[model samples]
Target: MVRSILIFVITYALFLISGFLFQIDQSWYDALNKPAWTPAGGTIGMIWSILFACIAASITIIDRKAGGLNNLKPAFWIILIVNYLSNQLFSFFQFSQKNLGLATIDCAIVAISAIILTVFALNIRKIAGILLVPYVLWTSFATFLSFMFYSMNL
Candidate 1:
């Protein structure tokens, strides 16, 4: 159980660290002709960092209760992977070369992945379900932001 949680924490830490490696300057982002309502990069980063932490903690609790890796459900693994990957990919789409279209699609994917992960997490642990609440909410908000960005930019 503790082992399972450990894995989630470690993976999440790496995910975060990887993000920090890419330096997206605020000035650069601002210089780009963004839509009127796009959030400041720091604000978005902080929110995502917090949400990712919560998700890490939530899955850890579930992992502990589930009696370690073998007992952990496949859906749990898949959704987590998808969520993490989508999160990582969005940075690429949003920051690298500034592709609003790809960013919108990736953000939507993250939102859907959150929904699926939340559902699967619920089946494994109620706390896990509750844990995903912030993630789900933010992702939904991001979807709107992305959609708006796409519409405005395109």
Candidate 2:
């Protein structure tokens, strides 16, 4: 139980670090012609926070089932890292660089990675896998949102 808590903390910390490193350019983002369905900035942050909490909880469950982080398959780590990086890249491309095309591509990768993570987790632990459903759904929606941004702005 202690180990699971530790893993959750570490996982969440990494998420925070990624967010800090990929700080959004609010001024540039505000200039974009966003879709009507786009959530407010605060709502976006709240959604991400909820999603990250879900991810951290799911990771803890997986860590417990796998006997430890070290015991998990290499593929799990690879997918997790790829998903995190792809997610960060979406923010970087969309807000920092203001490149909707590249951002859309990054978001697509993120959605794909989320699906991969869910399938891989299911193979490891049923409940752990189930926990990723929300992540997958959210990423799918985000991918659509990114596509809309790209299409509307271009």
CA lDDT of each candidate? 0.79, 0.85
Residue 82 lDDT (model 1): 85
- Model 1 lDDT, full chain set: 0.79
lDDT of 1 by residue, 1-154 (tens): 5576577778578668647755566676666665677787779879878887888877677767787646876767887788888888887877775787898899999999999988888888898899899999999999888877777656
Model 1 regions more than 4 Å off: 1-5, 33-37
Candidate 2: what lDDT? 0.85
Candidate 1: C-alpha RMSD after superposition: 2.3
